[model samples]
Target: MRLPLGLAAYRALSWRAAQPAQEPSAPRPEGALLWLHATSAERLAALADLGQRLCAQRQGVNLLLTVNAAVAPTEPAALHTASGRVGPVLALTSDHPGLIRDFLNHWRPDICLWTGGDLMPNLICMAAEQGTEMILADVNAASLPRRRGGWLSDVTGPCLMRFDAILTDTAETATHLRRLGLPGRRIAAMGRLSTGASPPPCPDTALNAATQLLAARPLWLAALLDHDEIAPVLAAHRDALRFQHRLLLVAVPADADDTANLIATARDNGLRSADWHGGDPIGEETQILICDDSGDLGLWYRMAPLTFIGGSLRPTARGNTPYEATALGSALLYGPHVADHAAAYARLAEAGAARCVRDTASLAAAVIQLSAPDHAAAMALAGWETVTESAALTDHLIEMIQDRLDQREAAAHARA
Candidate 1:
């Protein structure tokens, strides 16, 4: 007869646990452990920088990063440089259990973070045995097959039961974990980490210039545009023109070539356009300003009262970040394909702070309707309120970690 499924799963878990731990050559001081499951080296580097900032904020805490070895050498190298400045970094070969074990043994971190993908059973078991706090942040597991198969059982279920806490990106995920047997008290619905990322300090000159250009005009932002979004965006711009002649649309291209196409499309639609590539001033007649610079989305979001997050209009794009616009006090609009930032956008929409458009015509109609001065101002206010309301999640996570640390110290003292 075949073994019962639960029994078989339990046996597998036990067998994996019985294997000898990977041993490293040298012992290092215990510190806060951070495991970066980054989708790319660039993202890993960004997380490492944030880790450093967190450590600087709180003294007596050391951060050690374990990154995927499969990440491109250049990206890992960038993380290496950043980690060196803050703490130590260990890059692990993907699927290499022994190397991962050895690194875990050597670092002996107080807390283990899993960010990019599903938590592996072996890793979760190891962290549990060591009494380390485990958390998964900014996670996206929307692929329906993965959800149905329940691949996270071994790691997420038992490990979640063992760990001090589990902070997830969405209420739906928290509900799923509860159904899997994790205690409700132990689960907190924290939004994406990218929401908490610090915005760059705004330059007074740029802020003044942007404010002056906007100068009482009904301004809106169309950010991170994919190739197919250009024509529809142009249509939306024209629709907005029916209500206001001084309407301004700022186009932030996802790629360099897209910028040219966007400008050409705007010209064809009967609007004068200018590119910010050469740092030219926005002339009085310029209706669309193509902003081609990287990392300036924060500034642009702040400058506009209402913003449409691009990449959602095209099915190929996974959607850009809406939290940036929300955080910067701009009301948001997006398309249907925002699988990546779904939770964030959904929350804002439910709060009446955002709207979702199905296609070009719907997008144009929404733009024209929202361009009303009072309506735009109310939506902007609602968006800011939603952002501030969610701010408690970060504080709640921090308090939980501190409580766990205290409990660990008390247990250690009792043992002595």
Candidate 2:
């Protein structure tokens, strides 16, 4: 095949310098390997949920996850999360034509989910020639490669044309691609590629009972409360109630033993307390209701629009995922110690969906600020948008990927 002038130029420049050596990796896993790529760690965060879903849904499917010249990840072929294996993570090789071919030859992925707009000419061209199924997703105009040289005829259009399908995050992005000469049928406004797990299940009867019982009281939840963190949480809640006198704090302990400490802290703060397990009555004077040690947070999340995740105040902040709150229409508040879920919290913080508190004072202030209906509503809306921005479209796309993989595997077996 004749190389387009733009692609030819790209290949020449891409290989002008010595390509970095590919890192040593283990033998590829046997099965239908699905490879995914993003330009940076932040972009890679969007793929984590997808990778986890793929790995969980189809045990036979192997994932090869990569980031482009961004921070390299340890492990290969399957992305890993705390709970299970998503797939191996690696840094993509520099776009040198030879290395590109070498990398593809080694992996031999059945399909590629390429995050859209940051087109790699040599890599795309090589992959296309090798008959790899390429799908461009989360297309954004701002993410497209900017013109560095006028002399190089635009290669983005041609590189994108190689993709089997181009799904955009918005109609504007689809329209932008159309202006680049991609056909209408080839592009669809599929919204963003983002992920959030379903909110914890809360039955309607329980939700309505709690909502009516609260009777317009300012409410906040501190869930998965660490033993040491209980004191600080109660202190913050007590401080918050000074200004918002009708405030109610619902607490859920991380461990059953932690319940004793929580009740003691509430008493120390001179706040009236109700314990779910102890069968203490919840009356108008009751300010703290300790949820039954079940640690089921769905009911509390639905009861309160403001949530402060526990365990985030310690040095080893094993914080909860912020999506659980955002997915349940609650605004998030966490502490300085969120290394485990830094990307998720960062994403939410950037969008004004979450707030970070350094100490009890800040947590108290956040609670007070969120007490106002308008303020809480705005943050809740932002949380909903930030966490769920691309959830539906991404879910559909994931299903499509699975179906395609299944079809290919079935055909391959027949051929064998």
Candidate 3:
């Protein structure tokens, strides 16, 4: 009485093919196409960063992200997905030949970037046969299959050589790849690709209004403060207020539960405060602005030139990302407990983009010194450069992809 599932699926496929090649939500069909495949969603996050960079630079480039269907929902929430923005995600469990052909024909990616382990042999061979340019990145020795020296020994060797570029994690992986039949010249050991956070959009009118209201006020922000960090932050503000009487402190807590304690502390220390959530006005006499709203970080980061990222004054509380503030032209001040983002903090420190303070005395001293316009301007420039450091690898990948595309175009033209 009912049709079989396979038969219905085939009919649906036929209907889709008959309608059109392009989906309305997808990018235009005439431009360059990039295909990205990741062994896991974690790896996909890094590849998605690369895709975002490529789309930002190239005028008409389309990206298609592919991942295993099993791990899509459970992927870590901290990582950036860029789903549906750059392109749609294609979930491939097992590569059926007919389905693979349909997907390739529909998207027709000009360049392909695959990350992590577990290469699909059929997909690689078919894509190679169709002359698609491919790159393999973030691979390691563990990614290779075992059980060699048999009738089917090294069966996927030729397929592995299809990639134009291969970047592995360690020198051992590079050695393993060369032994696996991929040319030594095409493979190298490089560090993992970097991931960057997208800049949150801030409305220009709102930014202008805030800037006008806070005109000529020497201000700094204490962002995402924890309960343990309140005393040190308030003490630092108290010390800094001595030299600059007109100085303002924009205090925002990581948890709203600490809000009442913070306001009580500010008033107890003889500082006039304005509670943003309680409809209090920031009059000329207000020394501390308590922003109880957690969602308006974009506003504070832009309003203040120097931001002290909270939750790092104590050893137990690790810090948040420094790029979010640096990306908005804010110079950073943080304590030493930055184990969560050690690489980013180290880079910013080395570049002279940020300063490290141990206690309230040191924090107050650094705040007073950085309040000078010339010093803050130079530090802000360094911080901006540090946040955009991913552009180096991005440019490198773009050059390689473009060169391969040019070569393929020339070869096709010669044949014609």
Candidate 4:
């Protein structure tokens, strides 16, 4: 029987099924392998952030990210891969048993988590049979694609049963899952699986060295700055420098490709600056320190007490999350374009952790005001508290994973 979609869908499935399967040569690490799946790029980004949180909670844990080929993860996951923590990404093809089994055998995943609505019945059921604890999160049945003959429920029912827990984004999703034979007790109406992430680890030696070198200097970070943002950030620095000649700007460009241009721009602004990637020092004469390396955000987040999260001052791009800056003890100054993380930013604003700036003038004024030790410390404390509150959700997810893993261990012990 031809599965419900159209000829195009059938051909796509056939092509995927025909692809050869192979056991990856990469050695599986000692700990559990978290298999995370997401259908869209946005969900992939959320999963990447979640994976980062999970790894932070458990030492030496490896994550196996699986996303649809069309929505390959780039930014944050690439960042983790570059840091040598996350394992090589596994691009899933078809729901073919052979392909899924080959991947499971090679990676030996201990747990599996799928986000969004799409369901691959064979793969999910096989994973459950192999004793992998499976979870379906952020489920919304309305978003799930329907087949021409209403065959979706038929195929999804048994596979839904295999999940250890089903976290629904709405009561409707929970109702649908319950109708499909998932027990009411195993399903809960949890919101979206997205959560703020912890700051990436920074080397202590580097952090200490930078802290020591910049001692007593009024320093602030222009974090994840873009090329267009160079002018405003530099202008803000210049404006702030008038009052405090000892002020230093730690400018981390969003794109490393912009470093040379950023350096030129800084010089054009009549500011003495050093490029950290090029082994330049943060001298007393240096007005801006260009952090060309992206990986050292953790270090900079810790070094600076006040940060202007870039990519927001301009209208073209939304800003990066302030959670990391706040988590690492930095009071935030962001532009009005923080729609991407509006909820997280709103909580920060409510807690007096972050202040929104409309232009270079406002940014400069906010920076100068936050540069004061007493005021900055209080904002940083508020930001930290906000981050801690967000951790309640993370802690809940962690507890679920731990309980499932512990249950498996106990079962094995009883069998022995």
lDDT at residue 415 of model 4 (Cα atoms): 100
Mark the regions of model 4 whose C-alpha exceeds 4 Å error after superposition.
1-33, 40-63, 73-83, 105-108, 147-152, 179-181, 200-220, 224-232, 239-306, 310-323, 326-390
lDDT of 2 by residue, 171-237 (tens): 9878877876778887888887765766788888877877777767778889888888898889998
- Per-candidate Cα lDDT values, in order, are 0.67, 0.79, 0.75, 0.77
- Over the stretch 159-252, how does candidate 4's per-residue lDDT look in tens digits? 6778888888778778866775669999988766544556879998997888788887889999998888889889989999998899999999
How would you encode candidate 1's per-residue C-alpha lDDT over 1-416 as one tens digit per residue? 23345434754655564444443544565644444444444345445645655566566566666665555453544455556665555555443345446656766777766554434545656665665677665554451113347745433455445555666768887787677776888777776553333454577788887787667667788988888988998888887777777888888888877777887898889888878766766766778888886567867887888888988988767786576687777888999997656656776788788999988788878888888868877887877776665346545545555565667668878999
Inter-residue clash pairs, candidate 4? none
lDDT of 2: 0.79
Model 4, poorest ten-residue lDDT window? 74-83
lDDT: worst 10-residue window of model 2? 74-83
Error of 3 at 66 (Å): 12
Best by lDDT: 2
Quote the positional error of residue 16 for candidate 2 in Å: 5.8
How would you encode candidate 3's per-residue C-alpha lDDT over 1-416 as one tens digit per residue? 23235333533454465332333334437867778887765466557777777677667677788876454544433223347455567666555555667667777778888877677665665676677888887776666665456211243455566788888778887887777666899998875555555666688887887788887798999999889888889989999999888899999999988899899999888889998768788888999999876677898888888999987889887677787888888889999987656666777889898999988999999999988877877888999986675555556777787676667669778999
Best by TM-score: 2
Off by over 4 Å in 3: 1-48, 51-133, 136-162, 165-193, 392-416
Compared with the true structure, the alpha-carbon lDDT of candidate 4 equals 0.77
Error of 3 at 368 (Å): 1.4
- Going through the candidates in order, what is the number of backbone clashes in each? 0, 8, 0, 0
